[model samples]
Structure formats: structure tokens, C-alpha cells
Target chain A: MKNKGLLLVVSAPSGCGKGTILGEILKDDSFYYSISATTRAPREGEQDGVNYHFITKEEFEQRIAQGGMLEYAQYCGNYYGTPKKEVEQMRDAGRDVILEIEVEGAMKVRALCPDAVFLFIAPPSVEELRRRLNKRGTEAAEVIEERVSQAARELSYADRYDYIIVNGELEKAIQDFRTVVRAEKLRTKNGNKIDEVLNHA
Target chain B: MKNKGLLLVVSAPSGCGKGTILGEILKDDSFYYSISATTRAPREGEQDGVNYHFITKEEFEQRIAQGGMLEYAQYCGNYYGTPKKEVEQMRDAGRDVILEIEVEGAMKVRALCPDAVFLFIAPPSVEELRRRLNKRGTEAAEVIEERVSQAARELSYADRYDYIIVNGELEKAIQDFRTVVRAEKLRTKNGNKIDEVLNHA
Candidate 1:
């Protein structure tokens, strides 16, 4: 029998290099990146159902009212949420799904799917985070300061995560990420088939 | 600060190829093979402190009374037990320690060190185990049957272990074992130093 796929929930503060780490992890096709359903219009060159499953605000609210959304939030005056059916379908088909969300959304996912593995990617330090934000040069000084403060709050939630990886060295962090996935597969909960295999052997 | 090494408890049924697997794992000097203490007299070429910490019955009982042993059992008119201090010393020095014992002893160690990782190595099947035991030619036919029955009992406890590796393909089992060890080291409990390093950075 095919094993059920693991639901991996990854969360990190902005500028913590989580995107780069997750990008490396997704290079292997074994993972299914969960696409969020958003009520906002697609950006330039963003394709529907690829960048996101774009929906009307009314439709999004209807789905929420029908309890179709796994987790949803109002972001920049638009609804952004995980479509429960797609994730369930992918997982039931034995495709490991990756859900990259913020702490609030991640906690919501945890409550919804307690079996999911919650991983937190952290920057090397608050100082390093400040440096990365400043180096981006895309935000105003006050905005960068605000992001840094927000990051400190996020870091406080690290202990609540099942695993934490400090994205200090890219290769090392990637290896750690892979190791967690590999080892988690070997857990007794996932390897129950071994008993049947042995029984038949 | 040096991270405390992991106390790995390995258990397997007889003729499950645990010794060979453990030999491969010990090829790396990062692990300290825990030497068991016993009141049984040493055979030829069995060196004290190397083969076993041969102790007198009085001494063994004394240590047991003083709570120096992690786990102990009386078998064939002799006391066999794990010395708690040696395991602690090795772990304090950041050297992972392997305690290869039976399920009863493993349960004892678990009670003492709840943080220890407990792994159970299993054979592909009871039939395969019987074949291996018969091939050894070291035991009588009745003895082999007894061992096969005992293995069945041990197999039932596989779920109690944190991880179970079926020794079907030797290399694959070894890789699974190594992966578990590597991934466990990355756990937040063991990687708390990352926070300190980041704070200092």
C-alpha cells in the first residue's frame, strides 16, 4: 500500500531566507507545493492556478462560509487561504505537500492538522535579520525597523515548532531540511506496512 | 558549549543481524559502544573493561543498590547490567553512546533516560529469522525454535520503539539508522546552541 504523504508546514519571518531554502527543497518533484486561493487579481505574468487560484471575493467568502478553506485571512483587503480539498486530494494520493505560511496561519493549520510537521526556519540572529532587511533596500527605514521588530516576535514562536533550522549556511540548512523529511518517513507511524511485509515474507 | 550526546538504545531479536548492523555503525568513532557489566566469569580472550566490566556478585548487587546501574537483570545465576556512569560520561563528552540490549532492558533504560532514542531492528520475517538461526548451526533445533518464538514476541513491541528498521536490505537499514541519528541531532532540544551562536553573532 502507498504511504500517506506528510503535510509539512514551514514558517519563518520575512528576510530569513526561507524562500531560498524552500526553493532548494522543491527542486525535487516529490513535494507538492500548496497553492493558496486568493481573492486578489493576479500580478503581471502570474498565471491563474499556477501562481495562485484566483477567485472572486464573493466566491472566496462563499467557500469560507461553506468551510472549504483550511485556513484563511484578510491580507491587504483580500482573502488568502489554503483550499482544503486540494491539499487533502494531494495527500491522499501520496504526494507530500508543503505549506509555507506565517505563524498565525501555521498555528491554524496545526489546529486543523495536528499530524502535520511544523518547521520553523530562523535567521542567524536579530542583527543578521536587520542586515538582510537593510540590504534589500526595498523598504523605508521605518518599515525595515518594523519588520525587524516583527521578526523578533516570530522568533519567540520557534519553540512551538517541531523543528527549527537556522538558515546560516545554505547547503547545511538544505541538508538538515532533507534529513528531517527522510527521517520522518521512517517513523513507526509511517512504517506500519513493514509489519504486513514481514508477515507475508 | 558542547551539546550532550544522544543515548541511543538499540534492541533486536536474535538472528536479526543487529550485530552486523551495529558493527557498521560503530565504524565511525563518534559512537561509544557501551560496555555492559556482568557477574558472569569472562571466557578466554575476554578482557576486563573491554569485553565486559566483570564484577563479583557482591559488587554487582552493591552497585545495583547504589543505583549505579541503568538496568540490570539476573540470568543464568549472574547479574548483567548497564553501568549508568559510563554512559553519562561518554554523553557528557559529546560522544553518542550505543546501548544494545533486549526489550526488557531497553524499557528499563527508557524509564531512566526518557530522552534516549529507542530503536528496534527487525528481521524481514519470522521465517527469515529462523533460516538465519538455523544457518548459524550454533544452536540445537529446539533452541532455534525457542528463539523464533521469542523473536515473535519481540516483534510485537516494534511499535513501542521510536523508530523501527526492518533489516531486509542491509545497506538500506544502515542508511535508515544513520538518517535517524543525523536527523535527531538536528532536533530543537539538541540544537539550542544555535540560538546562543546566533545571539553572539
Candidate 2:
């Protein structure tokens, strides 16, 4: 019997290095990254399905009406959400799917699929987080302060997650994330292949 | 803050290669093996506290009355059980303690320490298990048959375990066991070191 894929919901506060850790993990082709469906126009050199599933506003609204969107949010008059069908299909095909989102979106996914493994990535320290945000130089000082406060609030929810990995070092953090996926596959619920092998023998 | 050691309850049917797997894992010196206190006389070269904690029957009974034994059983007029204080001390010192027991003892540990990680190791197939038992050449034919039947009954309880590892290849089985321990330590309830670092920073 083929093993079913695991749905992993990864959440982290801003500047917690979740993106870097995920980028390293996705370098291996074993995982299927869940692409977000957006009403925004595709950028230059971005493929429709590879980067984001570009959809019309009317189509996005229709998907929401039909309950096709797992979770969605409107930002700058554009709809961004995860398509439930694609995720389900990938999982059914025995391909592990990773959905990287913020705390609120992760909460939504938790409601939709309670069995999904929820992991919260955290920075080694709040001071370190503040340093990373400042190093990015993408936001103004006031915006960075707001992000730091927002991160503290998000960290409060870390206890609700199934696993918490502190991004102290890049390589160690990536390895820890991979370990979570590997160990979860060995759970009794997912390791039923043993039964089939034994019975057939 | 130091991370607390994990209590690991490992169970496997006879001839499942759990002994071999654990031998390889303990060679690293990272784990403290839980020594069993026994009323039986120690064989030559079996030092106290190293092999078995040789104790008098009266002492064993007193410990049992005091609830010092994590789990105990009687066979051939001898008492054999785990000493809870030693296991707790090892874990409190950030050293993982492994309790290698049979299915019934594992169930007892589960009731006493629900937070401990319970792992069930299985053979690749029933045929493979029978082959391994025969290869040992220590048991009579009738005894081997009894062991095989017992193994079948024990396999039924694998689903009750938190993790099940099929001991197909020796190296792979050891790797899976280590992965379970590593992943369990990262669980949010035990990963409080993250909180200390964040707060102090």
C-alpha cells in the first residue's frame, strides 16, 4: 500500500528565518510546495503555476463562493488564498505538501485540516529578530518596530503548534525541519505499510 | 536552561532485532540504559548496577510497596522491575533513558508517563521474524512456535504506540529510532529552551 502524504503547516513571525529554512528544504524535490492563488497579475518571468496561480478576480470570488479556497485574504484589493483541490490532490498522490503562511492563515488551515502537522519557526532571540529585520532594510524604522511587536504577539501562539524550531543556525534549523517530516512519516497512522507487507508475506 | 531528557519506552516482539538496533544506538554513549532490579542471583562477571541491580526478594518487595518500581513482573520465583529513581535522575540530568521492555510493560509505562515517547519496532514480515528466531538456534522447535504466535499477538498492539519502526535493515531501523527521539525533543512542550533564550535576550 502506498503511504499518504503529510500536510505540513509552517508558520513563523516576520524575520524569523522561516523563508530561508524553507528555501533550503524545498531544494530537495521530494516535497510539493503549495502555490497560492492570487488575483494579482503575474510578474515578469513568473510561470502561472510555478510561482503563483494567477486567476481573475471573478474566478477567485467564485472559488470562494464554492468553498474551493482553503483560506483567503484580501490585500490591496486582491484576493490571495490556498486552493484546496490542488493540495488535496497532491496529498492523495503521496506527495508531502507544505503551506507557509502567517499565524492567522495557519489558524485557518488548522480549522480546515486538523491532522496537518503545524510547525512554528522562531528566532533564537527577540534581539536577534530585531537585528534581522533591521538588516533587511526593506521597511522604515517605524515599520520595523511594528513588525517586532507583531512578532511578540505571534510568538505567544507558538505553544499551540505541534513543534517549535528555533532558527539559531541555518543548517541546524533546516535539518530539524527535515527531521520533523521524516519522523512524522513514521507515525503509526502513516506506517500502515508494515501491515500490508506482513500480511502479504 | 537545560533541556530535560526524554523518557523512551521501546517495545518489540521477540526476534524483531530490537536488541541489535539498540546496541548500535547505545554505542554513542549519549543514552543511559535503565537497569532492571532483579531478585535473581547475578551470573559471573555481572556487576551490580551495570548489568542488573541485584537485590534481595525482600528489598524488591519493599520497593514495590513503596511504588519505586516503574513496572515489575514475577517469573520462576524472581522479581524483575525498573527502578524509577534512577530513570528519573537520568532524565532530569538531560540524559535520555531507554526502557526496553515487552508489550505489557510498555503499556504500564504509557499509563505512568504519558509524555514519554513510545516506539514499537517490528520485523519486515512475519516470515522474516520466524527466520530470525530460527537463526538464533537457542530455542527448541516448540518454543520457537510459541514465540512466533506471541509475536503475532504483540504486533496487534503496534498501532497503540506513538511511533512504529519496521526493522527491515539494521542501519535504517536505528536511524528511524534516533529520528523519533530527535523529533520528540523538539516538541513544543519540551523545547522550552527557546523561551529562555528569547526572554533573556
Candidate 3:
């Protein structure tokens, strides 16, 4: 039987370095990034299946009806959910799977997959988070204010996470993430090396 | 009511740099290193209460009889145990308590303190561990062999640890240890700063 890969759940405030770190983590061969399925219209230059599995609302509803989605939620009048097939296939192939979801979705996924490692990525401070959001220069003042407020709310649940990674330094944060992944691999349930030693010795 | 500090259980093989990492960790103002009471004669240059609480067999037995020690173990013809009073007082003062104990004593501490964070420090490879053991230049070849064998055996229980820190690089291992500490401090049961916000807000 093939060994199953670890399920990693990552949550962060909007402006935190989750995307950047997740992108770096994707470079590792042993990890498979779980592509989300959504009913929202695909943004410019975004691929239909690569960036997201962009489907019509009816198609999304059908998947929800058939229990194909692992966790689904309606956000901004659009449906978003994690597809079960790809994640299961990757895990069965002995490749770790990563889920980048909001805090609320991460909590739901935790209930569904209690074995997954829940990581909360936070900026060094709330002021730093605001600075990053302001530097983005994509939203208006009102929108930025709303985002800052939501960020405060998201951070309030940081204690519920199994691990908290501070995004103060990119290289340090990346190293810590790598350490967590390596340590997780050595886990009894996940590491075959441990089993091999036990069975032989 | 005062907040209880997290009880940190640190365990490692004989030559895994556990002592060095722990020494640095103890220097942090937020951490209080537990002074173990021993029933052995103090070595030259070793302070009575600073390096260890050197007590007579009678005093040790009396403390044991009075239910004062957290966990006691007989090793190499000497009894060593963590003093309960100092650890409790440090915890009451909101300083995290660090226990540097062997695997057996670590397991005992875990049973007594279920919320404690158990971390296992490990060398990169068995060969490296041997090199470190030999480099000490204080133990005989046969004794070093015995220690390596014991380390191999201890490593078999790595699965029991909450986190494994590989001492490949000193700074990296220190950072990883600190990351785990920061994360544990953010846990809901210990301080629950995050929970307090979400509920109150």
C-alpha cells in the first residue's frame, strides 16, 4: 500500500504572506497544492482549471448535491469549495496536499480532516498588516478599512491554530515552514522510515 | 486569577545539542529553567542550589514523602527530581517552565502535565551523532558505543514527540525551537489571548 501524504491547512489574513510562502512550498516535489473550485468568474489571465476550476453556478450546485466538494461556502454571491478527487488522488500517490483557505473555511476543514496540520500565518503586527495592505494599492480607502477590520477578526482565532508562523522575515518564515514539513514527515503515522526501522529492528 | 505558564518538556539523545539549545532558551526572560533536585554529591565548581539543588538522601526522601517532587527517577545510583514548588511559582508568575529531562522522565512529565509541549531534539544522522559523541573526548569508546546504541533506541520513539528539531545548524535549530515556543504561547488553553478577543468583540 502506498503511504498517504499529510494534509496541511493554511490560514491567514488577506495581506499576510500566505500566497508567497505557498508558492515557494509548491516548488517542492513531495507537495501538491490543492486547486479550489469556484463559481466566480475567472479573472483576467487566470486559467479555467489551473488557477481555479471555474464552473457555472449550476455545475457547482450539482457537485454540492452529489457531495463532491469537501467543504463549500458562499462568498460574495459565489460558491467556492475544495474538490475531493484531486486531493484524494495526490494523497494516495504519497504526495502531501496543501489547502490555502480562509480561517472560517480552515475551521470547517479541521472538522472534516482532524489529522490535517492547521497553520495560521500572521504578519509581525497589526500595523504591519495594514502597511502591507496599503502598499498593495488595489483597493479604495473604505475597502482597505473593511479589510483591516476583517483582519483583526481573523487574528482573533489565531490561538485555535496548531501552528502560528510570523511573516516578519521571508527566509526565516520559509525555513520554519520547511522544518514543520520535515518534522511532520517523521511522524509515526506519516513517516515510512520509522515503520521500516521498527519492522526490521 | 493568574495565568499558568506552559510546561515545556524537552528530550533528546545524549549528543543531540539539547544542552546547548536549552541553555540559550533559558537565557530568555520569559522562560524559567527548572532546577532539578539531586541526591548526588556536587562536583567541583557546581553550586549547591544554582546548578542543582544538591540534597541528602534523607532530605530527598522527605521531599518525596511530602509530595513535593514533580517526577523523580533513579539514574546511575542517584535520584533526580524536579522541585514542584519552584516550577509552580514560576508558572504562577507567567514565565514558561522548561524541563530538560530524559525520555523516561519526559513521558512522566507529559502524563502529569497534559498541556505541556513535548519537543525532541535530534542530530541530522546517526553518523553525526557518533561524531558528536566522540568529539566530547571524555567518554571511553565502549561507553560511546553504548550511548549511540541508547540513542538509536530513544529515536525509535520520535513519533511520541510533538515536534522534532534537527540540530544540523545551531541558529536554525534555535529558530525552530523558538517558533514552536511562540506558537505554543498562542494556544487557546494556556493564555487564550485570541479567544478573549473573539468572544469579547
Candidate 4:
């Protein structure tokens, strides 16, 4: 029996280094990173489908009305949302799809996709998070402070996630992410071989 | 703060090759395999606590009456049980404990340890199971038939398990077992680092 792919959603606070880990995993090509559809105008170098599924505001609203958007948000007078049909189609095709978004967006996805595996990446400690943010050296001190506080607020919502991975070490975190996806495939809700085996008997 | 160890229970049908996979994992010494206590007399080379926790019938009865056993059974004239105190102590001390038991005993453990992780190992197919049993050559035709039917009965209870791993290739099966353990450790209920990280902040 062909097992349906996993619909995985991940949420992480700033400075957790989850981006690096996700970058490594997405390189495997086994996963389909979800691309958002938006009403925002494409920038000079942005491609319609590659960068974002650039769509008209009317169509975006129509998709929302038709319940095609998994999760959506309004920013700077533009609408952005994950296209649910693409995710569902990819998953039904036995291709795992990943959605890396913020905690609020993850919650919206959770409401829409109850079976999606929710993973929250956390830093080892708040001090470590601050140190990593400071090490970037690109942000001003006030900006760094703002991000740290935002991270703390985000951590408050971490418990709402199904799984929490403490990103203490990069290698261990990547392995944990992979393990979570692998194990979720074997979950009784996701896939069970017993019936398939018994039927084959 | 140190995270509590995993309380894991495994149930598998005959010929699933779970024993071989478990043997490979137990070589790590990170797991404490639960040993059963019994009232049967030790035969040659049977050592106390090694083969079984040899105890008198009266003590076994007393332990059962005191609710010390997580699960118990009687066969021929001997009583056998898993002591609950030791499992609790090991888990509290951050030592993971593995309980490889039948479906019945696993259900008993479930009632006692609500936080336990339950895994069901499955063969590739019922035909493959029969093939493996036949290759053993120790059992007669009728005995093999009995086991095959019993396996079907056990498969009925597989849905109650939290995760199901199909044992096809030995190496993949072993890795799947390890991945399940790793992912289970990251579950929100098992060892959530949110509070620990927040408290440290």
C-alpha cells in the first residue's frame, strides 16, 4: 500500500537556528516546502510560482471564500496565505509537505489540518538565544532586545505545539527533525501496515 | 532539570523480527529492560534477577495483593508479574525502561502508566509471517496453524497502539525503532523543554 505523505508544520522563535536545520533537510528533495499564495505585487526579481504563487487580490479573496487557503494573514494592505489545495494534492501524491511559519500561523494551520505534525523549535536557553542574536551584529541593540522579547512571547505558545525540540546543538536538532518526520509516518493515524498485511493474507 | 526517562511498551506478533531489532538496540545500555518476577523454582543455570526474580509463592501473592505488580499472570502452578516500584524508580532516575510484552500485558501496563509510549511491530505480511514460522522447523503443522491464527487475533489489537512499525528489512526496522524512540522523547508530554528553558531564563 502506498502511504500518504505527512503534512508537517513547524514553528520556531527567532535566533533558534531552525532555518539552517530546515535548509539542510529541504536539500534532500523528499520534502515539498509549501509556497504561499499572495495578493502582494511581485518584486523586481521574484518569479510568480517560484518565489510566491502571485495571485490577484480578487482571486485570493475567492480562494479564501472557497476554503482553499489553509492559513492566511494580512500585512501592509496585502493578503498572504498558504494554498491548501496544493498541500493536500502534494500529500495525496505521497509527497511530504512542510510549512515553516510563525506560532500564530501554525495555530491556524492546526485548526485547518488536524492531522498535520506540529513541531516547535526552541533554543536551549534564553541567554543562548540572546547571545546568538547579538552575534549576528546586523541588528541594533534595541532591535535585538525587541526580537528577544518576541521570542519569549513565542516561547509562551510553544506548549501548544505537539512536539518541542530544544535546538541546543545544530546536528542533534536536524536529526531530531528528521526522526520526527520518519516516526510520524509510522503513526497509526498516518499509516498502519496491519490491515494491509492481513488483507494480503 | 533532568528529564524523566521514557516508559515504553512494545507489542508484536510472532515472526515480526522485533526481538532481533530490540536486541540490537539494547546493546546501547541506555535502556533498562524490565525483568519479571516469578514463583517458579529455578532450573539449572537459572539465576535470581537474571533469568527471573525468583521469589516464593507467598511473596508473589503478597506483592500482587499490595498492588505492587504492573501486570501479572498465572501458568501451570507459578505466578509471574512485573513489579511497578522498580519501573517507577528507574523512570524517575532518568533511566529509560523497555517492556516487551504481549498485547494483554501491554494493556495492563497502559492502565497503570498513562504516560507510557506504546509501539506495535508488524510483519510485512501474514504470508511472510507464515513463511518465517515454517523456516523455524521447530513447530509442527498444527502448532504453526495455531500460531498464525493467534497472530491474527493479536493484529486486531494493533490499532490501540500509538505507533505501528512494519518490520520488512532488518536495518530499516532497527532504524525505525530508534527513530520512534527519539521522536517520542520530543513529544509534548514526554520531555517538554519549554518550562525548563523558560525557568532558566
- By DockQ, the best candidate is 4
Which segments of model 2 are wrong by more than 4 Å?
A40-47, A56-62, A74-78, A197-199, B197-199
lDDT of 3: 0.82
Model 4 spans with C-alpha error above 4 angstroms: A197-201, B197-201
Cα TM-score per model? 0.91, 0.91, 0.73, 0.92
Residue B81 Cα positional deviation in candidate 4, in Å, after optimal superposition: 2.2
**CA-lDDT, candidates in order:** 0.89, 0.88, 0.82, 0.88
What would the DockQ be for model 3? 0.18
Kindly list the per-residue Cα lDDT of model 2 for residues A46-112, writing each as its tens digit: 9998889999999999999999999999899999999999999988888889998888899988888
TM-score of the B chain in model 2?
0.93
Selected candidate, larger TM-score, 2 vs 3: 2
Q: What does the lDDT read for residue A147 in candidate 3?
A: 93
Encode model 3's per-residue lDDT on A112-149: one tens digit a residue.
88778877887777777777899999989889889989
| Separate clash counts for every candidate | 0, 0, 0, 0
RMSD of each: 2.4, 2.4, 5.0, 2.3
Higher-ranked by TM-score: 1 or 4: 4
Residue pairs clashing in model 1 are: none
What lDDT is reached at residue B68 by model 1? 96
TM match of model 3 to true structure:
0.73
Per-residue accuracy of model 4 over B1-201 as CA lDDT, tens digit each? 678889889989888898898889889777888888999999999999887899999999999899999999888989988988988898888888988899998898888789998899888778888999999999998999999999989988898888887888889888888999888888887876589645375
By DockQ, is 1 or 3 better?
Answer: 1
lDDT of 1 at A185: 83
**DockQ (model 1, Cα):** 0.53
Which wins on lDDT, candidate 1 or candidate 2?
A: 1
